[model samples]
Target chain A: MIKKRFILNFPPDSGDKPFSYHLVKDYDIRINILKAEVYPGKRGSLLLELQGKKDNIEKGVEYLNKQNIICESLDKRIHFKEEKCIDCGNCTAVCFAGSLTMNRDSWKLEFDKEKCVVCELCIPACPLHLFEIDFR
Target chain B: MQKTKTYEEINLKLKSGKAVILTAEEVAKMALECSPEDILEKVDVVTTATFGAMCSSGAIINFGHASPPIRMEKIRLNGVPCYEGLAAVDSYIGATACDPDNPSYGGAHVIQDLLEGKDVLLEAWGKGTDCYPRKHIRTKINISTINEFTLFNPRNAYQNYNVAVNSTKKMIHTYMGTLLPNLRNATYSTSGELSPLLNDPGFRTIGLGTRIFLGGTQGFVVWPGTQFNTSKPKNEYGIPVSNSATIAVMGNLKEMSPEYLQAAYYDKYGVSLFVGIGIPIPILDVEMARRVSVNNSQIETSVLDYGTEGTPKLGQVTYSELQSGTIKIGGQKIRTAPVSSLSKARKIAGELKKWLQNGDFEITKPVQMFPKNTSLKSLKETEADND
Candidate 1:
């Protein structure tokens, strides 16, 4: 299965429509709404992770474009260079979103991609330069 | 106090490969199953460590003389300003010293870069004397090329400290990292139970001339740090409930590494140094082992509201409460964040333990004890003309 993240921008009027529900019902795609600020009569945004067959993901994007809801695919995400990481957990101190955390038992660093907000705060906090922004 | 183990006994055990070593945190955990006497009998030494932002820390470097030599006056390293008030070629780089033109990088960063073996741009303009003719020099130097590099920190390892939070609507950056305003978040720095000063509390085993593991090397406690408050109120443990004491530490900067000595910046809070320090608390007896086994729940500190101009102390809270990642203030649940990396603290403690077992490092008894009941007073102006 192919997965992609996107920043969905909605026109003020389109905020009233249900985009995610339709994407799942019509396109047979799995939707994970990472963040959503869409409100009725407001120009808002929705961050989503869409997963499905490659053809279905493309068709879903085509549908979003036809509705004038600008959907931009995101390429930026936090990537941990495990080899360089010493499991120091310095990155966890600044990761307000709980993206990086230490395993209590093993005392090793555990990274959760979905929880990361791409704040780049961890980039400078790490002494070994183990964290990077992966554009994929 | 129960028959405390002598310092010599502990050393002998370590030398003979029969000594049992444990980190402060481990001792705290063992406290549940083992009594103080049992622990004292089994453990010879308990290693303590802390990694946190220390603003009053810096290094004094004696770069030796250049060809012919010049009386160095103005000096800067890696764009960070350095104090040239020392002798001819000696320079003191302060932890809070930031890049002269840009505020992003600071002296702490420069020191870390030096430890990383990076070539730093050293620019100095000195007065040319008859004997020392050179006037100005711009050179790239690394830690290995320097003659003498000393980590002479005036204050470090605060016994206990305040948890920082903001009372205002806007966020404020501090040496403690970002404090979300309106009690939204709190930031704390100490390694809590694993900290050196916290484990020893009363300086029974730790004092002036005490050998320590500092920045990945053996170091010493030179003196009591600035702003030390030995008069603070103590709990049943004979330790203060808030920040009380600190140590002036000295170590060879050449033997340090970037892993333990890090450069950090807290956004608008400016530059501060993250010092890695480990103190081996000798299980001198049951009393010492019991002291070392103190847990975060037993240790407490104040939570200060930093958004206010006065930075008033909000209330007293235990490290256990802070470590749980949240605390209630004014009936609202506030998220807590750690400024010090306990993971790094644990790493330092483990490293120090290996050094001791492998016979690479040894502990030293204090030549002189730290001052007890000492008072810190501010300078006052005298009335001369009126009198």
Candidate 2:
């Protein structure tokens, strides 16, 4: 269950290539498109979530690289200051993705990074000065 | 009138033995285990609490006159204008007041800066008169240097509030925080069943001079809150669905902590303070205990259309429904979120409960019961002189 977010860049002159189709048929990988702004003979950008075996995921990335597509991993990251978080469950509401949630048993906030879209909705939702977003 | 226990008897029970105390969150389970009469007889006190986005919250400071004694008129703390309507050195920095120079860092942040023990730039101007010499002053002042500091809030607790959402196609920012267009999200602010006023719906035990837990320290209720409206629709529980009675509270600023008091900012919604408050309700009788046992499913609030100027009710919902993480509106199950923090409120209630059991806290007798027949009046309907 190797999963990662990617920012794929397509050059304006990169010929008509079914970039996503090739990855699935050739490398046996799964691609979930988060966002895309691409067209024929136009520079394209795609935000994608890829899931597959570790070696197959690597092979898929190499395939995209040879196609003149810059496949950069988008580590859209957020950190919770454990001491500051009140665990009031405000984040769980604004978060469209279930990445941020409350553990019903402990009532403690459980943040699943795998499901986060980096929407930054939790930043303002928190009453306490917790949930800091750092994107590099 | 219904039978009720006096505040003295409960205090005696607390002092003589381990008082059967329960946090606001624990009341539901406690009720299921024992009858209301049985629980009421044994339970000395039920602690109610809330931590929410209270925009009208802030502190009043009286800075003893500086050398030459300038009669300060206009005042700004960290570029945020504070109300200097009181005599010379007195002013109030409200939570919603924004910084004139820098829009982002507002009065709420200034209050936070002071709580963090940081020196804030104090700038003021005045016209020198016969009694006062200096005209203007600019200096750094921290919480310690101030002569008197009081957290005087006109409306500390709102009995019930609306859950906000934007139904319009365009996004809108409001004091309720950013409301996404087309009902992408809904944000509600209230401690629900754990709120002090909710536990005592009819204002039975809450009134003037009632000792409370303010920012982890003991404080008092000064008077009925501004916009205290007793005239509103109520349910079987006697809890008003509309914005009902409010309370005016005062606490020592120096004795407060940053943990309970904080500054907050919404992307485009503006600044406000997170004030932690807890009030203890003595189970005077079975009736009082029944009131404290009010559940979230029984208490209700409205989801409002924030895209409009004045609040308009779009739908009616309960705290249980809101806390369930989803709410249905316009044939869609939209995600529901709370602007208030129940976790923080529970913490405050638990802390007060400990203070009560340890004999560190004392419950004060209400000087007077809150008014019941008052109607909310507008400013235009009043005059300073006796009409």
Error of 1 at A74 (Å): 4.8
lDDT of 2 at B125: 90
Q: Write the per-residue lDDT of candidate 1 for residues B1-387, one digit (tens) a residue.
A: 347778887788788888899999999999988999999888888899988878889999887788978888889897788998987899999988987567768888888888888999998887888887889988999988998889989999999888888999986767676665678778787888899998888789898899999998999999999998899888887778878899999999999877888776666567878899999999887788789989989988888898998889888788888878688877788777676778889999999899878767677899998888886786676877753
Q: Score chain A of each prediction against the true chain A by TM-score and list the results.
A: 0.59, 0.65
Lowest lDDT sum, 10 consecutive residues, model 1 chain A, at: A127-136
Q: Superposing every Cα of model 2 onto the true structure, what RMSD results?
A: 4.2
TM-score for the A chain of candidate 2: 0.65
**Backbone clashes in model 2, listed as residue pairs:** B225-B246
State how far residue B14 of model 1 sits from its true place (Å): 1.3
For all candidates, state DockQ relative to the true structure. Answer: 0.22, 0.44
TM-score of the B chain in each candidate versus the native B chain? 0.95, 0.94
